[model samples]
Each structure stands twice: as C-alpha cells, then as structure tokens.
Target: MNDEKIVQRAIEGDDTAFLNLIQLYKIDLYKTGYSFLKNEEDVLEAIQEVTYRAYKNIRNVREASYFKTWLIRIMINYCNDQLKKKNRVVLGEEVLNFQGSADNYFAMEIQEAMLTLDDRSREILTLKYFHDLKIKDIADSMKRPEGTVKTWLNKALKSLREKLEEKGGKVNV
Candidate 1:
C-alpha cells in the first residue's frame, strides 16, 4: 500500500498498519538517527523512542502526505534532546571514520567538514543533500519560514565551503 493509505490506516488505530509503516521507514529513521548519534546503541535507542512516540501520536499527524516529514521531525527533536542530555559535540575525526575506497574517503572528508558547523547548519545540509528533501518540506519539518530555511541552507553551504577550504580542500562553491 501507498504510504498515505498506510498512514491513514495507522491514524485509525490499525496496529498492523502502524507497524508496517514503521518497517517501511526503518532504514531512513536509522540513518537519520545515526547521523546525529554515531553510536549504534544510541541510534537504536533513538529509533525505538521515535517509533513509540510516532505510534502513540499518529493521530496528531494532520496530513498523510507529510507522514515521513512528521516522523523525521520527531526523530530530529529526540536526537537533539539526547545530544543536550549528553552535552555531545560532533568532532570531525570522532564522527567521520573514513575507512573505505577513495570516493568514500572524499565523502567522509566532506562529512568531517560538515561536522564543524553548528547543529542547525548541519541539519539543513543533511535534509537538503543527504535526505534529498525539498526546501518547502524542510521548512515545514523545521517549523520555519521557507525564506529562513533558504537563508540557513545558503549559510550552511558557505560554512561548509569555508571549512573545506581551511582544510586545503578545493571547494567549488
């Protein structure tokens, strides 16, 4: 079934539909959680918490079309709360462990540069690039104006470029 249909079913208190919905997005949720939390255990914990919260509050989601965005917002908020509790700051070498092919290494280098940014900048970059979310969806998920989201996205790209240049990497942007 389509996500919207499944979401509608879930909102109607179909336990199986909710479980199916969670299963469908499990990998995305795991990856999103892992981006904030490098540890496997913590990522798993965040996913579990997000799942429970989403299931309990499924009815609160107004639009079935935005189910994924709503779930991601919850996960992001949960991850932020976890970060606050641990007072964790994502350092380059600690978070981006680059061990693989040369292409993967370069990608990891960019990720390391991204780690230098503030949480909000990193988040916008992730949503735009990694998750491939459009500006409108990002703005909605963040509860910010589209213009604000655009400004933040530009700032994030600029900051990423600066960081990359500082590390002697050539940044086109």
Candidate 2:
C-alpha cells in the first residue's frame, strides 16, 4: 500500500497500519536519531520514544502526503529535546558515514566544519544532502517557504565553505 493510505489507516486507529508505517520509516528514524545522538543506545531510546510519540500523535498529521515528513519531524523534535536535556555535542561520525569514499583527513575537516553550523543550517544541509530530501520536501517538513529553504541551503553551503577554508581544507560544499 502507498504511504498515504497507510497513514490514513493509521490515523483511523488501525494498529497494523500504524505498525506498518513505523516499519516503513524505521531506518529514517534511526538515521535521524543517530545524526543527533551519535550513540547507538541513545538512538535506540530515541526510536522507542519517537515510536510512542508518533503513535500517540498520528492523528495530528496535517496531510497524508506529508506523513513521512511529519514522522521525521517527530523524530527530529525528540532528538533535539534529548540533546538539550543531555547537553550533548554533535560530532563527525555521521559525516564520515555519509562520505564513505572520502579520506580520513577530508572527512575530519568536513566533520569539524559541520560541528560549527547552527542547528537550522545543519538541519538544512543534512536533510538536503545526507538524507537526499528535496528542497520542497524540506520546506514542507520545516513549515517554511520553499524560497526560505533554498536561501538557507545556500547560506549553509557558503558557511560550510568558509569554515573549510578557515581550516585550509578544500572547498567543495
């Protein structure tokens, strides 16, 4: 079944449909959690918490088409809260994981640069590049205008470039 139908059924309090929705997006939830937590245990905790939250709030989804984005937002909000509660610092392993073919030095530089980004900028970059989400989807998920998202993406790339340059690393963002 399509995600929209599954989401519709889930919203109607269909347990199986909800489970199916969770199963379909589990990997996405995991990856998003890991990006923030950088710890398997914490990611697992986030996943559990997010699953509960998603199930509890499935009916709140504004549109069936945005179900995936809505689900991801729940994960993101949970992860952000956990990070705030724990006062954790996000690091570079996620960047290395995403850039498999890059050398350690390049990856390290990229990671360091990434660490300096503000939450919004980092989110834009990660959602746009790491997760391969389109600009429109990101805008929808973020509840921002598409032009705003594009502007943020551009600014984020520029910031990333400047940070890399400051470290004497190559600029390819």
Candidate 3:
C-alpha cells in the first residue's frame, strides 16, 4: 500500500501497518537522528523514542501523504531533546568514518568544518546533502521560508569551505 493507506491503517490501530511504516522509515530516521546526536547510542535511543512517539501519535497525523516529512521532523525534535538531556557538545564530524583515500580525508575535513557551524547551519547542510532533501522540503521540515533556507545553505557551505581551507584541506576545483 501507499504511504497514505499505510498511515490510515496505522491510525486505525493496525499494528502491522505501524510496523511496516517503521520498517520503511527506520533507516532514514536513524540517519536523521545520527546527524543530530552524532553518537550511536544516542541515535539508538532517539530512534526508539521517536518510533514510540510516532506509533502513539499516528492518529494525530492529519496529512497522511506527508508521513515521511512528519516522521523526520519528529526524529529531529527527539534528537534535539536527547541533546538537551545529555548536554553534549558535538564538534566536528563525530559521526562520519574516514576509511578511504586522500580525497576521503578532505571530505572528513569538510564534515569537521561543517560541525563548526551552529546547529541550524549544520542541520541545513545535513538535510540538504546527506538526506538529499529539496529546498522546499527542508524549509517545511525546518519551519523556515524557502528563501531563508537557501540563504542559510549558501552561507553554511561557504563557511564550511573556508574552514576546511583554513585547516589546509583542499577540495578539487
């Protein structure tokens, strides 16, 4: 079934429907949580919490077609809450593993530079690149305007590049 149908089923108290929904979105939700928490344990916890919350609040979801976006936003909020609870400071790319060639090193450097940015900038870059979300989707997920999301993305990329360059990291022209 489609997302709408699955969501309707879930809202009607179908356990299998909710399970299917979780199965479909688990990876994306985990990745979204990882982007914010930057720790495996925290990601796991946030995912669990988000899954529970989503299941519990399935009936409250008005727009069934927007299930993915809605779930992602919930994951984001859950990750933020986890961050607050832990009071952890995640600087640099604590999540990415650099196990490739010289180019990979630079990519890691870029990720580290990205981590130097504020939470909003880092989130914009993560959602744009890692999740490959569109400008409007990001704006909606982040509750920001399209133009504002574009502006933030531009500034974040420029800042990340500058930081990488400052760290003697070179990106291929």
Candidate 4:
C-alpha cells in the first residue's frame, strides 16, 4: 500500500496498518534517534516512546502525505525530552565509541563536529542532510517559518565548517 493510504488507515484505527507504518519507517526513526542519543539503549527507548506517542496521536496528523515528517518530529521531541531528563551532555568520545567503527576517519570527524552543535542546529542539519528533507518539510516539522529555517541552516553549516576546520578537516561550507 502507498504510504498515504497506510497512514490514512492508521489514522482510522487499523492496528495492522499502524504496525505496517511503524515498520516502514522504523529504520529512519532509529537513525534519527541515534543522531541525538548516546547509546543504543537510549535510542531504543526513544523509538519506543515515539511509537507509542504516534500511535496515540495519529489522528492529529492532518496530512497523510506528511506522516513521515510528523513521525520524525515526534521522535525528535521525545529524544529531546529524554536528554533533558538525563541532564547530561554526551561527550564526543562516548558518541564515537557507540558507533565502534574506526574505519571511517572522515565520518568520525564529522560526527564529532556535529556533536558540538546545539540541539536546534544539529536537528536542522540532520533533517536537511541525513533525512534529506526539503526546506518546507523541515520548517513544518520544526514549526518554524521558512526564512528562520534557512537562517538556522546557514548558521549550522557555518558552525559545522568551522568545527571541521578546527580539527584539520576540509569541508566546503
């Protein structure tokens, strides 16, 4: 079934359709959660919370076509809330260790740099680059104006560039 139809069915209280929708987007949601969270356990917890919240509030999603974005927004919010509850910032070492891959030096540097950004900046960058979301969709998911999203995107890129440069990595801003 098409995503829109599946979402519609989910909104109409079809349990199987809801499970299907979650299965379709599980990897994306997990990756999004991992981007902010420190450990696999935390990421899994965040995903569980997001799933529960999405299931309960599926009816609030106004557009079937935007179900993915809506689901991601919920995941992001839940991850943020978890972070706040922990009241601890994850160090770069911990984040890097979580991946446990030493083969990609460049990716490691980029991930380290991303860890330096504030939550909003990192979120904008993640949505734009990792999720490959359009500006309009990002703005909608973030509940911000397009112009503001643009500004934040630019600032995030600039900050990422500076951090990369500081670590002797070259990236075009």
- Measured by lDDT, the strongest candidate is 4
Give me the runs in candidate 2 sitting further than 4 Å from their true place.
90-102
Tell me the tens digit of each residue's lDDT in model 1 across 1-173: 68899999999999999999999999889988877776788889999999999998999998898898888878878877887787756543543564677677666668667656787997888778878899999998778999999999999999999988887767785
- For every candidate in turn, the CA RMSD to the true structure comes to 2.7, 3.2, 3.3, 2.8
Range of the 10 consecutive residues with the lowest summed lDDT in candidate 1: 89-98
Comparing 2 with 3 on lDDT, the higher-scoring candidate is 2
Q: Which is superior by lDDT, 1 or 3?
A: 1
**Model 3, TM vs. native:** 0.78
Cα lDDT of model 2 by residue, 12-73, tens digit: 99999999989998999898887667778889998999899988888888889888878777
lDDT agreement with native, every candidate: 0.83, 0.82, 0.78, 0.85
The residue-by-residue lDDT of candidate 4 on 1-173, one tens digit each, is 68999999999999999999999999999998887775788889888889999999999998898899899888877877777787776643554455656555667777778877888898888888989999999998778899999999999999999999998856776
Clashes of each: 0, 0, 0, 0
- Model 4 stretches astray by more than 4 angstroms: 91-103
What is the Å distance of residue 70 in model 2 from its true position? 1.1
Query: Clash number for model 1?
Result: 0
Clashes of 3: 0
